[model samples]
Target: MSKIDPELKKKLLKESQAPFKGLRKIVWIAFSGSAFLGLFIMLAKIASGNELQLNNLLIQLCACIVFPTLLFVDRNKD
Candidate 1:
């Protein structure tokens, strides 16, 4: 078995990185993914002969890029 204690490894990982950095990153990725999916849905509707609103598609794309980055949120509790 490894000699290092589990708690020690957990503590070491916490100390080595800023807490909540990973959380914020994950949230951003999820937000972007959802936005991309929304845009894709609109495109699919158009392919089926349903009218796709260009503005809505553009808005979704912009939201995917802008929403996640809008937060100047950073892990300050290092």
Candidate 2:
């Protein structure tokens, strides 16, 4: 095999070891997922002809907030 240059190897290692390299991606996914789930629940309730309940809104709000917080905590623990 051809030998890799020392400088190139160092740069690659630095990027690979970045702890928060994909934090933005994770947060984005969490936000979108929470939003989609919340919408789905809302739509299901509408389809069933139930009046929108406070509990439904609370569930969605909690999901949107809790998931991101949990993700940040988990990432920082590493």
Candidate 3:
């Protein structure tokens, strides 16, 4: 029978816990960027006196708010 070293076990455990940390950050950035962009576009439309689309505005607002909030929560989990 073989036994794992403590250091090696610790490293493996840490690595396994967040194997997709980088990927998760990338996805979070992409989604957050798009949410901000959508909010900006909606604001532009309002500034230009275009008819307001309530549903679209709400969706953008939620995305803009929710994504960052989710990221914050995810970070605190670590």
lDDT ranking of the models: 3, 1, 2
Q: What would the per-residue lDDT of candidate 2 be over residues 1-78, giving only the tens digit for each residue?
A: 749998998878876776565775587677859776877878788899988977877778777777666656555333
TM-score of each: 0.55, 0.43, 0.78
The local distance difference test score of each candidate is 0.76, 0.73, 0.84
When sorted by TM-score, best at the front, the candidate numbers are: 3, 1, 2
lDDT of 3 by residue, 1-78 (tens): 549998999978877987876677778878999999989988998999998879989999999998887676667353
Between which residue pairs do clashes occur in model 3? Answer: none
Worst 10 residues of 3 by lDDT: 69-78
The most accurate candidate by lDDT is 3
* TM-score-better candidate, 1 vs 3: 3
Residues 1-78, model 1: lDDT tens digits:
879999999888875776666777777778877887987888789889998678888899898778566434542444
